[model samples]
Target: MFVSELMSTRLITVELDDKLSAVKEIFESVNIHHLLVIESKMVFGVVSDRDLYKALSPNIGTRTETSKDTATLNKRVHQIASRRPIVLPVSATIEEAIYIFNTHNISCIPIVDHEMEPIGIITTRSILKALDEKKITLLATCKTQ
Candidate 1:
């Protein structure tokens, strides 16, 4: 399978200047794991939920340091987002995508066009779903044999 076939076109994006508080809100509201950071309609970086958690204070549940957390949230998205991500061409194979995922320690890859414009996002979950489908096919083939 190719990445373009599996990549998700429905994306949630944020500008580099957007606040971390806004990012937190989007993650909380959408149950999404990553947000693409775009500038001038071109992808600049990617911010994962882990990145948000790492950047924020751990005393978030204590309420006492809520102010600290809020201050952290006031940071710009570009400050927290990882820049120069490993992007995949829309034609990249699933094997290539998985290799990049495993080798790069990245959970997501922003699929891009020739112009470096993001067309979609591919995640570990998407790869897993494809694997599951292949597993089902293999199991059925074994049963028939």
Candidate 2:
């Protein structure tokens, strides 16, 4: 099947300049693991929850805020975002998507169109779900055999 068939249309994204704390809040609020970093409605990169945690590490560098207030501090997403993310066109086959994911060691990939506009997201979870459904169908056939 094609990526467009199983990709998620309700994409969660973050701007390049958005603060790290804000990204963290969105991560927690939505219970999502990653966010697509977009610029001008185009895919720029991706930011994961792990990236935020690393950026907030005390030993990384300067501590922008003291113990009192941390949420107000600013940490640009671009500074920690993963650039040159593994992106695929919405028409890519599931096998192609899996290859990209395995090659790059990524769990998700952003789907873009010819214009490079963000269209949807394809994740390992979606692939696994598809596999599970296929397995169920196969099992049903076995039972009837």
Best lDDT among the predictions, by candidate number = 1
lDDT of 1 by residue, 38-88 (tens): 999889999999999898887765758777666887888989999989999
What are the per-residue Cα lDDT tens digits for candidate 2 across 35-118? Answer: 999998889999988788877745333566464345333779989999878899987987788778878878889999887788
Model 1 RMSD, rounded to 1 decimal: 3.5
TM-score for each model: 0.87, 0.80
CA RMSD of each candidate after superposition: 3.5, 5.1
Looking at model 2, residue 106 earns an lDDT score of 85
Candidate 2 TM-score over all chains jointly: 0.80
Q: Which stretches of candidate 1 lie over 4 Å from their true place?
A: 135-145
Question: Candidate 2 at residue 34, lDDT?
Answer: 79
Per-residue lDDT of 69 in model 2: 46
Q: RMSD in Å for candidate 2, one decimal?
A: 5.1
Clashing pairs in 2: none
